[model samples]
Structure formats: structure tokens, C-alpha cells
Target: MSIHLVTGAGSGIGAAVARRLLERGDELWLLARDAGRAKALAAGFPGARTLVGDLAEPSRLSWALGHQAPPDRLDSLLHIAGVVELGDIGDLTPKVWNETLAVNLVGPAELTRLFLPQLRLSRGHVVFVNSGAGLDAHAQWGPYAASKHGLKALADALRREEHPGGLRVTSVFPGRTATPMQAKVHQQEGKRYDAERWIAPESVATTVLTAIDLPQDAEITDLTVRPGR
Candidate 1:
């Protein structure tokens, strides 16, 4: 059976992806910060495994990667854990800036590094859940935008470097998905951002599954999924 590891598997797109993969008869390992949430999610799936650790912590992530019976090869690594901090330049603080970068860019980068061996062993694929902000900058989204931009560049560079080894890397940019993150951003703005009109997390999850299911000889490279007006 194909073994897929997904971060941020406790909710939203991650949860949907986990369920979809399970339905397809794939073994899934979900990583999340909240043990309770992870357990709850795992319970919903008969054989799925859940690991609790903060991806932002290098030591914890390293331990999780090392101790796990390194899958003969990981079929896919979905780096989906991320955070968005919305604020103007004046409202930005060091803590908020660093937290956003840590979760959105640094953690994924570090996790990829630690899992490179397993990925190479399986010649597996890596998928990044990026955002539209990664492609275009908007006012008051400086930190979030910058982090996603870095993530996009990182994914591209990794893809190029690993192509010879058969490891495919894809960065997906989804525009305004109706996930908890969107709710948080909307709350910060004190208004809804056309929530009903936005794309659903399930749609984004389908895009991710598509990227993973592509033929080994092909790579999706970069894909952008957006809601139609």
C-alpha cells in the first residue's frame, strides 16, 4: 500500500485530503500539533496513524521523521500546515512576523529536508499548499505574502534539484479557500470576505490528490486553483 504523510491533517483541507486518501485505500500518517484533534481524526479512519508535534519545532519534527519506520519510500509528502497573519505594516510585530514565517515557510522547508532520504528512497512526490498571495502581493498582507513567496521559490528549487532522482515537487496556490484560516482572517477584518463565494477546502483537497496521482513520468510543477466568480 502507498504510504502518504500529510502535515496539518487535523482540519480543513488536510482533513479532507486524509479522508479522501483513506477512501482510496492508501495508508496515511497525519501530523498535527494538537494530540486530541489528531486522535479524533485518526479515529474516524480505521487504520490511519496520527502523530502529534509542532512542525515549527525542528527537534520534534526530526524525531518524528527519524523514529518512524522510514517507509520503504513515502509515496507523497504534503506540507499543508500553515498560518496567515493579516496586518498592515504598522501593525506588524516581530512575534507575528516570525510565527508566520516559521509555520508557513521555515517548518515546511525543514520537514522536507529531514524527509529527503525517505522521499528519495521512494522517489516520492512533494506537494506544497501555497496561497494566491505567493503569486501577487496585496496591501496589508506583507508578512503572509512574503512567507508564501519564499515557500514557492523553495518548492521550485527543490523540484529542480530533485528531478534527476525522480522526486516530483508541486506547489499549489489556492485563492481564498473557505477554511478556518479564512475565518480567522475574516474575523480580523471584522467582515466577511464573500465566504460563500470562495472555494471550498474539499476542492483544494481534490487538487492535491490530483497532483499526487499524476504519472511518475510527469510533474504538475505549479498549479493555481481559484474560485469562479
Candidate 2:
């Protein structure tokens, strides 16, 4: 069985992906900021491990990855943890911009870099759970949109760099998923956002698993999953 590591495993797409991996009989390592939530979610799985820390913290990420006995060189690393903050351009602050970029781009990139040796050894795949915002722009989503755009570029560039080394990368751009993040956006906008009718966390998880299962010779460079009208 292959070993998989997933970030943002406390809830939403991250939780769904962890469950899917467990159901497939793969060993799973769940990284989340909440110790209780991570432990609770990992309770039922036989080979699941939970690491609690903020992904935005470089030292925490390093400690989590190296503190424990490393699992048999991960077969897959899913960068599913992210932060979404909605606000008009006028509302943008240094703190908001920094936090958004830290969780959505910097942290994921640093974590991937730290794990490159293990990934190269296994010839594994890296999946970035990006958003439609990464491809297109939306009003009042300045920080989130910019961060995702940066992440998309990072994923594409990494894929190109690792192609000859047998590493595959996929950027999964999902639109308006039904999650707490969506609720936060709607609340911030003070209006109803109907895009929620299309994307579900489980559906995104399925797409992610499909990308993970593809043959090494084939690659789905970027995937866009949107809700159909």
C-alpha cells in the first residue's frame, strides 16, 4: 500500500481526501492545526497518523515532518490546506495579505521543498488543491485570488522542473465548493453566492484521487472542476 500525506486534514476537502485514502487502504498522515480535531478524525483509521501545527509556520512544519519517524518515503503529498479571506481592495491590510500568502502559497511551497528528497526517491506525485480563483479573478477576493494565482504558477513550474525526475504535479482548481470557506466568503460579502450548488468536497476528493492514480507516463497538468448549470 502506498503512503500519503495530506495537509488541512481537520475538515473540508482535506478531511475528505484523508478519508478516501484510508478507505483505499493506504497509510495516511494527517496534518492540521487542531490537535483535537486531527486526533478525532484519525481515531478510526488503523494506520493513520496526525500532526498538529499551523502550516504557515515553517518551524512547525519542519518539526512535524522530521520529529516522528518518517513514513516510508511518501507516495503522494496533497497540499490541500489553505486560507480564504474575502474583502474589497480597499479592505486589504498587510496582515491579511501576509496570512493569505503564507498559508496558500509560501507554506505549501516550503513543505514541498523540504520533502523533495523523499518524493524524488519514490518518484511520487504532488497535488495542489488550488481554486478557480487561481485561473480567473473575482471582486473582493484580492488576497485569496493573488495567492492562488501565485500557487498555480508555482505548481506549473515545479511540474516542469520535476518532469525528468519522474515526479508528477497536478493543480486541482475547484469552483465554489460547499465548505466553511464558502460560508466565510458569503458572510464577508454580505450577500448570497449561488456557486455553492455545484462543487462538493467529496466530489473534489474523487477528482484528486483520480489524479493520484493516473499512470506515471501520463499527467493531468491542470484540472478545472466546476459546477454545471
Candidate 3:
């Protein structure tokens, strides 16, 4: 069975993706900001490992994972942890902008770097759960959009750097998924949260699994899944 590591395993899309991986009989190592939540989720699976820490500080995450006696063979790294704080460019605070970049971009980038040796041993795939904001900016979504755009650039650079080493990298751009984050966005917009109006997290997970299951000779570099209005 392949070994997978997933960040942001507490809830929403991250949780959904972890469940799907478990169902496929692959071993999972989950990381979340709350260790207790990750432990609770791990209890449901037979042999799952959970790490508790904030992604904003990748060094802490590295220390925690190192203590886990990480498996030598890692088949995939799924970077699903993210934060979205919206504000127009003019109104975005320095603190918010810094936190956004740290959590959404730097954290993932650093995690991948720390795990690169293990991943290279197995020729593993790296998947980044990006958003539509990475593609086009919205009026008041400046901070979030900037972080995602940087994520897109990071993914592209990694793909170019690692393809020669047999590593596959994918960036998934999902549009307005019906997640807790989406609920928060709705609150900001003064609109009722309608689950049907957005894409389902499970659907996105399915796409990720499909990409991972592709023939070793083939790679799906980028995928965009959007809601059908």
C-alpha cells in the first residue's frame, strides 16, 4: 500500500480527502493545527498517524514530523491546509497579508522541501489544493488571491525542478467549494450559504485520487474543477 501525508486534516476538504485515501486502503499520516482533532480522526482508521502543529511555522512542523519516525517511503504529499482572509488591496493590513502568505504559500513550500528527500526515494507525487483565486483576482479578495497566485508559481517551479527526478506535481484549482471557508466567504458577502451553489469537497477529492492513480508514465500537471451554475 502507498503511504500518503495530508495537511489540514481536521475538517473540510482536507478531512474529506483523508477519508477517501483511507477508503482506498492507503496508509495516511495526517497533520492539523489541532492535535486532538487529528488524533480523533485517526482513531477511526486502523493505523493512521497524526501530527499536530501550525503550518505557519514550518520548522515546528518539521520537528513534530521528525519525531513520528516518518516512513522512509512516502508516496504522496497533499498540501490542503490554507487560510482565506479577504480585503481590498487598499484595506488589507500588513499582519493579515503576512499571515496569509505564511500559512498558504510559505508553509506548503517549506513542507515540500523538508519532505523532498523522502518523496524522491519513492518518486512520489505532490498535489497542491489551490483555488480559482490563483487564476483571477476578485474585487475584495486581494490578500487571498495574492497568496494563491504565489502558490501557482511555486507549483510551476517545483514541477520544472522535479520532473527530471520522476516526481509528479499537480495543482488543483477548485472554485468556491462548499466548505467551512466558503461559509465564511458567504458571511462576508452577506449571502446565505447554499451548499448546492458550490462544488463539493468530495468531488475534488475524487479528482485528486484519479490523478494519483494514473499510469506512471503519465502525469496530470494541473486540473481545475469549477461549479456548474
Candidate 4:
């Protein structure tokens, strides 16, 4: 069975993706800020492992994942953890910007780097769960948009650097989804939080699984999933 590592496994898209992978009997290593939630989610999968820590701080990753032995190869790496803070440029503070970047961009970059050796051995796929904001910034999405933009750049660079080695890198840019983060965004925008108006996390997970299931010789470099208009 293929082995995958998924971050942000506590809820929303991350959890959905993790569940899908486990359903297929693929082994999973999940990382989340909520240890209890992670453990609970992995309870049904005997091959699943969970780690708890702030992924934004890469220094804590070692300790968080220390309980399990390092794998000789990793089939996939899914960077799904992210933080969103809504505010216009003038209203946003440096702390908000820093936190956003740390969680969305820097942390994933380091985690990918750390897993490179194993990935290289398996010629694995790396997928980043980006947002539509990464393509165009909205009035109050400065910090989050900037971080996603940076994440896009990171994915691009990784694809270029690893393509020759048979490592596939994909960036999945999805529009607003029915997630807790989207609820917060809607609240800040003074808009009603309507789940029907957004894409389902399961839909995004389906897209991700599609990318992972593609022929080994083919690569889906970029994927964009949005709600039907």
C-alpha cells in the first residue's frame, strides 16, 4: 500500500482527504494541532499514526513525529495545514502576516525539505492545498492571499527542481469551500455563512485522489477545483 503524510488532519479538507486515503487502505501519518482529534480520527485505521504540534513551527516537528520510525520511502506528501486572518492592509498587523506565512508557506516548505530523502527514493507526489486567493487577492484577504501566493511559488520551484528526479509536485487551487475557515471569512465579511454556496471538502479530496491516482508517467501539475456557478 502507498504511504502518505497529511498535515492539518484535525478537520475540514485535511480530515476529509485523510479519511479517503485510509478508506483505500493506504497508510497515513497525520499531523495536527489537536492531538485528541488526530488520535480519534486515526482510531479506525490500524496503519495510521498521528502527531500533535504547531506545524507553523518546524522546530517542533521532530518531537511531534518522534514516536514513529522514519519510513524508508514516502509515496505522497500532502500539505493541507494553513491559517487565515482577515483584514485590509492597513488594519493587518505584522504578527498576522508573519503567522499566516509561517503556517501556510514556510512550515510546508521545511516539512517538504525534511521528507525529500524519502520522497526521492519513492519518486513521490507532493500536493499543496492552495486557494483562489493565491491567484487574485481580495480587499480583506491580504495576509492569507500573500501566504497562498508564496505557497504557489514554493510548489512551482519544487516541481522544477524535482521533475528530473521523477518527483511530482502539484498545487491544488480551490475556491471558497464549506469549511470552518470559510465560516470565519464570511463572518468577517459580514456575509451569511451558507454551506450550499461553497464547495464540499469531499469534492476537493476527490480531486486530490485523482491526482495521486494518475499514471506514473503522467503528472497533473496544477489542479483548480471550484463550485459550479
TM-score of each: 0.93, 0.92, 0.95, 0.93
lDDT per residue, candidate 4, 101-176, as tens digits?
9899888987888789999999999999999998999888899999999999999999999999999999999998
lDDT, candidate 3, 42-144, per-residue tens: 7865577876767877668777776667667799999998998877789888999888998999889988898899899999999999999999998999888
> Scored by CA lDDT, what does every candidate get?
0.86, 0.86, 0.87, 0.87
lDDT of 1 by residue, 76-123 (tens): 999988887788989799998888888888888887887788899989
Off by over 4 Å in 4: 34-37, 44-47, 62-68
In model 1, residue pairs whose N, Cα or C atoms come closer than 3 Å (at least 3 residues apart or on different chains), thus clashing, are none
Q: How much does each candidate deviate from the true structure in C-alpha RMSD?
A: 1.7, 1.9, 1.5, 1.8
lDDT of 2 by residue, 122-217 (tens): 999999999999998889888999999999999989998998999999999998898877877788878686645768899999999999999877
Most lDDT-accurate candidate: 3
Between which residue pairs do clashes occur in model 2?
Answer: none
Cα-based lDDT at residue 52, candidate 3? 70
